[model samples]
Target: MIFFEDTVSVVKVAVSLLLALASWLLIRFPAPFRHYLNPRPALTLWVSFIGLRVIPFIIVYLIMDFAPRSDTEFFYKKAIAAFAGKMVYRDFLSYHGPLFGYLISLPLYLWYNAKILIPFMAIVEFAIVWATWRYYQSSRPDALLMAVLYFLLPMPFVAMILSSEEDIWFWGVGLITLAYASRAQGSLWIGIIWGLSMIVIKSMIIVLLVPLFFLVDNKFKYVLGLAIVGIPSIVILYLLMGDAFLMPLQHSGYNMTPNIVSITRPFLSGVYNQISLTRLNTISLCITMALSSWAAIRYRHLGYRQIFPSLYVLTFGIFMLAQPSAPGFYLFMYMIVVLYEMVKIEDRSFNVQLILLNFLIVIEPIIWVIYVGMLNYDDWHTVFSSGVNTADYLIQVVEVGLLLALVWRTFVHLRSLDRAASQSFAASSQRTGSSPVS
Candidate 1:
């Protein structure tokens, strides 16, 4: 296959799996792995993340002379346009959030080079790891180990360092919000930040916020957050961009692979070009709302922070599968949550599921690229465009299967929490000589 820059993407895939394999072995078999590096696990994880990111960065940027591809380059152009005084939705075009352009362009404003984004994302990755370790260290023995596994989850590593996606920041913001609410110090600004982040980051972020409304102990904060922050932000954007700010509402984009559309493409060839984004958007939105509402009602007794780890998997499952365009980079945003929850479960089956999911996701783009030989979609023949077509469909099946496993596990998790809450309430009632009203 003709890969980007003659082997950059292929080699990057290999490197991603290497990092994942190394992390998998170390985490799965801690005894022998720790025998050599048990002196200071903290420092070891830091070095591992930094070293893994920096080394490939050097080889790709300096040695191979590889430049920013697709998304990264596209972001830079949008930022450049914005810097030149063109309005985002009104003057030009963007499928992402309003702030994506300005945010991605910060490197250009300071360093005047796009490559700074690589190291910038590396630093963000480290900071997220640090935050996870700091939060879980008191209770969990291998908090940093979980962070390391997340860092090397293959799709995330490739997305951050190679593709330069900013989706990880979504989780960063989530961790911050959860940290505050968990401590009972949540302020209006938390809501504002979360509310604004939905516009600034991605609309799919609302999946996280919607459940928080049901589960968070501080309903006033989220209620006012969406109201005080969400309304004014919308009015201002509408004022600024007029009808253009409502681009997301229009659902003008087409379907991509690994979605309901692409999944059906192999058989329903006629529906390929005829696929309706508006219809898909409607379906996706319906699915998201039903899932979010069900989760909220099911877990109303629990605190948001208490269930957020599994919440990430549950909500993002809808985010990934229900959406018209499901980018695998979305996994990096909450892979750590899945890792931490799986650590609590300690089930070998979950371990297999996590590994297989990451492996399939990491190669998802490569498989599509190999099959179509390009990123742009031209016609209905795209699915059967190349010889790798059959293998691609099988890979897509496994990918979907692994994601569905997460859905099942999340249901099991929420059910267990519900039972625990019920039992605890029953015990307390017996001690107090009282009974539930029902």
Candidate 2:
């Protein structure tokens, strides 16, 4: 029965990949057929928003069994427990932020069930689609395109809203904050507050804030805004939970043996335990920080809009690499960055590469699902305990390959921009009959 199930899963995956490739070919080639998928701007926007964001949740809820040991169940229980006056840090040892517990608990306040949380998250997904549309100042067709892509995108649908992961909420808040940060007329302070609020919900989201310094006009106001919200929140949390307030930070570092770092155990001499994993993560983090600093300095002149994607990819990519586990769901951020860049860049090769990269990103999680299905277990935790399989190692390799591809493409794009700027400056100097400055 297990072999039969695994074979069926493999067949399904093969068929899906073929269909995806065929669809991409059709979209890229036949000009007339392209118009067939295109609808009126407003109608497309609304349809994509509703169909992608809401309908999938309904479908998943009806189709899949909500596994008892799933992340959603874990969160639901924590939310309920927190709402019942249990201290999240002291009592539950939650690695999640305080605000996350309170936020998830809101759905339980009305009716207690995991299903109820879907709609709450779906609403946030709607906000993300809308904010993204506005952020790009895209045409109705472009807005519809983004909405459709996000909705149909496998990464967001499968890893996030389908599982009711908190990252979906964090992603939405991050998008809204980015939208505000990018606008010339938008308030930096408001963006700062929103960014800080995202951190309060999931401290990992603090990585998203790195780009805001480049995006915002007033650095001082941005710092002030962060301090305004951050200082008080920390003090209050400390007062409420005492030293337990620091538990999330500690919990964040706990090595979940399945991460990129742990996958290297076969190459190393030591046992693959938490302490070793933590040390590996520390080394990864240091490398990431150094590379990120160099990128920031080298690309300092790029506009906020242009540089924002690199900042996101670099920061989040590092976090994922350094963290104990790389949940396929988090790739949704990569999807967002790549999709936005695809729309913005005119280079056909770059766009195609981004499209292919997005496809690979989508495939990773599906592969993970198949691997888990092969385990034939009702409890999700059992699959983790069963140890890393060949499939797990394959997916990690795919992830690293995709990350390198994105980083390479970003650097190439930035260098092209620099070349164009230099050429334009030289031309202007010639026209003015003045030697170009050294």
Q: How many steric overlaps are in each model, in order?
A: 0, 0
The C-alpha stretches of model 1 lying farther than 4 A from their native spots are 1-6, 33-41, 182-190, 217-221, 248-252, 267-275, 344-346, 373-386, 423-438
Weakest ten-residue segment in model 1 by summed lDDT: 371-380
Among these predicted structures, which one has the highest TM-score?
A: 1
**lDDT tens readout by residue for model 2, 360-433:** 55554444455454332223344355444555555556666656666666666667766777798899999999
lDDT of 1 by residue, 148-267 (tens): 677667777777777777777777787887767755447455677787777677676766676666676667866787688778777888989787987755443655556555565556
User: RMSD to native for every prediction?
Assistant: 3.4, 5.7
Candidate 2's C-alpha runs over 4 A off are: 1-39, 62-69, 85-87, 91-93, 109-111, 137-143, 168-191, 208-221, 253-263, 269-275, 343-388, 420-438
Per-model TM-score, in order, reads 0.87, 0.76
